[model samples]
Target: MGSGTIVEVSDLFQNQPARLSFQRRPVTEMAKIVDIVMQHALSHPNVAFSLTNSGRIVFDVPSVSEYDDRLFDVLGTQASGLIPLSVPSEDENAPGDERWTGWISSPDITRGKGDEVHLFINQRPIASQPFQGAIRRGYKTRLMQGRHPIAILSLKIPPHEVDVNVHPTKRDVRLKHSWRVLERLERAIAHTLHSVATAPDSNASSLGIESIKETKTETETETYKKPSWAITATQQLTLSGDSARSLEPEKKRPISSSPAIQKTIFGGKPIAPALSSDERDIHRYSGIESERPDSEKPLSEIINELPEMEPLAQLADSYILVQSGEELLIVDQHALHERIRYERLKEDQNQWKPQSRISSISIELNPKEMSQLQAVSSTIKSFGFDFDIDSQSMIIHSAPAILTTSSIEDFMRDLLQDLSEDNQRALSMEKIKDEMAFMRACRGAVKANDKLSIAEMRRLLEDMRCIPNPWACVHGRPTAMRLTIHSLDHHFGRHG
Candidate 1:
């Protein structure tokens, strides 16, 4: 009968020595316990929480209205950088079982390891890849490779809709609509981060940056001042009524000016004499010179040739800035390069032919690793990996065309680990090959913060525009974003 429930285990695994033997060291066990306590405390700030180690108090937090205070107490003073995340209230159309709330760190706050992230479901701490991926997808490109953002995500779902008994540790759960949850979480985090990025920072705005103010006229219509950078993309247009009207010219041409022109006429107006055969041919082929063939044309020419897009400056050495017509385009150099590489790989795959004489390489594996390899051996063979396995080790005779000698071992190991985790699904050779291509693209692609010349940046932009899926990389990360004049005007209060 107390308000709180207490769980205790006595003579744990006494009947199962194997289970006890598999337990981690005491120090590691203690760390896990502390992690569980910290997660629960952080998830439920309304409850007074305390943790102790060997009769000594580690942390104590009284009940508080704000979770930020509790976070500081648990995660140390550095937790101040974490941004409070609030998902929009579920709409009437939203599933009643779906609920998510969390706090995400700013782009400035990150960790080399993903341990900084804590996920909870129904006030219970969970360790699920889908949940973790949701957080990563939310942070998206704001964080760099190998660096994960700090987050504390809390989720709630209807009991009937979730299967919590899927994992022995109760960390993994099966959601009836897992994709919906992930999509919602990602959208909420992205919206918050976007708002923070676009919002004027107090310190920066106070440092002599001119502030744009919105004004209302007698007609109650909101008006904004024109942005200073409006002319940066192209020649500035004067909105003067007379000048604007004068720019438009009337079109009048004689029907017989060309033989083709004579084909269409409203009335029997005076038609000029038909041109000579040579002249008619000349006129017929006049505009043909402008039509560029796809094979011979450059990428810029293929994409309508954005002559007005003058290269401005690169941002953070990662995003290339170019003025396109009246819009500013920010292109992610790494993502752009990755997409290019992936497309090249795809093209190569289409033209791929099996090798006549495949070379062999020997691979050594421990017993555990060997077992893992055997489990996925058939899948590996289907992926163009010709190999022979024995009790102790395995020898690879041929490898995938996409993989190199140096990376093959690591690639095989990773694939084995993945297969060990998910054995039920039949592995698709195409999927495996695509993943290989993705890895190669990631490794060979340009990295962030890498300097580039103006010509190089322009070339990359041109290539991106020519690609079918130029907006995102192979991994679905955004490669470029266009900031329009309207958005800029709105941001700078230059609207009417």
Candidate 2:
């Protein structure tokens, strides 16, 4: 309010009765204002800008010639892992030719949607599928499936070479040499992602675990069984932060008042049918365990229900190897946990627990995300989040009592990405909530490289018996594979 110029509009669309009748809620209108302002801010960061909603400061960016500084201010910690790249055009001396410049998000940080991948042409934010595709092709297989990277790229093209009048809002533009521009953009994104990048913290890269048929499964506990290795089904499911080895009964988490997410989460629909186990390496390689054992229960459930088959050992921090009766089972820790978490989230929407514990977290959401939030705010709130929103940013004051701060954050961001692009919207509301639960489980579960104690390993395996679907994770990766004693003996010629 000091030296900055102020412009205010009051009583807009008052005379247009039809438009007013169809007008969006105040929150939606504020989001649109914020989206347009943010586009302008990113395009011209050197120009100081400030936004307020109901006299609350949403964002205030000081004029800065350095783009990185502006990004650090706006994106907060997300900007820290960004990799900078400056690709040159042929005409270095020519001022009108297009040149590419901006920062790319490190592989470690990605969004579920390309919404965060901003493209500015001639200092104007514009939309181009070719531009976005180029950026993605650059990342290649580095990002997980359905996940997109965050990028802020700018190009200064000559007036004749770029047409910005393609849309009424000037958000979509046509490049005269679209093919050549895309080739260069793709190469730049690929080169930047490959060179001088952020390496992931762990070496366990089995999140996309292949069904290894003949892979060796060995751990330090392989030499033992009774006391040190094999755990029974009864010894699991006492969720603990301090002690994992407790031999206690599963203590159920109480379901709080309807999910704090006041909407769109649960539809009271029946749980979807469980998927049949995909007989990967275990079936093809050994040619054993193909036929299900004589049991009334599903094969997936039978693996965990066998009284003596608790986790015997952990391998590479990614898998659990167990010598269960006549069969040896290999388990994907992340996959198992994901399946369990997903089912638990669905066991009763009431388990989400009321939102509590105000946090000092704030995030900026674009218009698309804002719309997405409005669409399913109820589902989100039920999961333990309480927040206030302004035009440009959401101030998170509370988080889910069930999940850690970072875990729910990832789930929400991923959810926003999933809800966007209208692809998933073709699904029913029940399916949508199921997907949200899947995402939450994926985010909350342990990763491949996380080291687990024997107790933790046994406990996780024990928890597996509790879920309806236990064979594979939500993405169709097997949670556990079965190998028979007969297969082992046949391989080593012990049977002969």
Candidate 3:
């Protein structure tokens, strides 16, 4: 027999004509190979690894004692920003059998895709949803939606307690007690991140927000002031049961369009003059029809349709508290605004015209993102986004009036991801527009912790009431929660 049982196979899939016909892009295939090799190499730290690309050494990893050393070698400068994670013996009940260790990137050091998350079980690289979800749960509110943290996780579980041959590619593993393991991993990551925040290091501030020096450009410094009108004061309401209280309408001055004020009303959304009625009707025949015939109905009519409620007060600068009949309504200001914006975008899309040319904005895209954008460039242009693709960048010559420059990149990235996933390339014209509108609404809506005045808050509530589906946001999340007076009394010892 040949030494080491050397073997070579040629004419791959020769007998399978169907499989040979479906050819994957070279870059895509290479990326999968790189990912697989990286996963195996990261787990097997004792084994040295080298990657060659077209006769050139692209990446090299030397054998090392500690896992973090390999991470540093692979990620290079990027690894310096990561926080080391370890579980204390007291915190881990099965420390000997189910050992865990890893390094997690800080919130600022994030990726647009989940490719950076490399998880291994018992020194075997595997992809486990529970593991990924657990890591995400650990980060919780620290990361923004659509952003993924770069992490390297190693779980040393007993071989008999896990099953590895379930998946076709053996990429996943099933643990005997997965829920408990996931929970432990999540807790460990959270605690590690917390410790990093409180480590008294100059690199990170409290709450794990990065402490870095930022250079502000002229465009960043220039403030765009949006003029907002306040609504007439609503009826005052009283809170009963625990402690009786009455809210008085507070008079506030005209708000300046400070960064804080603009961020409060809408995050990164540009303030532009309203489009004319004729302008809005340009896309009427493009499969998008107005949801209501009375689209131009008076604002007062919409407000009148809402239940007779008294605005009580604002909660945590994010929620509006209102008293209606015997129920107390807790409205999420952000979600409510998102629903309103989504409806408005829908209306705008129906009237969108191919000839409409908004100001052009240059957006920088990475190689992979750029390729994805190029793939669906024509589809995007049909939605009123006229862009010219360049190497690692895109120049938009025309776009919808509602899209903000700062948020255009994020919007496009999210759109490209949806279109590129699973090779589902065929999409209807209306569906594309709808997806774009949803992304725009999500990005432009007011974020949490944005302070709003009593009048502005009341106007927002009235606006939300006008939407077709005011109960839920665009993402199907509940916009408000109602607590009945009886329910409140039952919670306490008074009614029971």
Residue-wise lDDT of candidate 1 within 202-318, one digit each (tens)?
121111111111111322211121223334667764422234343442334233565433323212453234444322222222211111112222443344343345668887766
Cα lDDT tens digits, model 3, 1-496, are 2233233667878898789667676544544455566777788888877766578554467789987788766655557778888674455554336777888887765555675677888788887555777787777545545567778888887889899888888886778877667767776776676555522222222111121212223221111111111113563321111123344545453656588644543445533334332222211111111122123322444633567666689876667898878988888776777677777777764435544445666766533455556556777877677778764468877666554444455456556666655566576767766755764554445655466667666677667667788887776766787777866666444564
The candidate maximizing TM-score is 2
Off-target runs (Cα >4 Å) in candidate 3 are 1-9, 21-27, 44-81, 91-95, 107-115, 140-148, 158-161, 176-180, 198-336, 346-420, 423-472, 475-496
Superposition TM-score, candidate 1 onto the true structure: 0.40
- Stretches of candidate 2 off by over 4 Å are 1-11, 88-96, 201-341, 348-351, 354-379, 386-402, 414-433, 440-473, 476-496
- Cα error of candidate 3 at position 87, Å: 1.5
Candidate ranking (TM-score, best to worst):
2, 3, 1
The clash count of every prediction, one per candidate, is 2, 13, 1
TM-score of every model versus the real structure: 0.40, 0.57, 0.53
Error of 3 at 272 (Å): 35
Worst 10 residues of 1 by lDDT: 205-214
Better of 1 and 2 by lDDT: 2
For 88-191, candidate 2 gives per-residue lDDT tens digits of: 33223432355778888876576666778778888888875557667766665455556667788888678899887878988888888776667556656655
Indicate the TM-score of model 2. Answer: 0.57
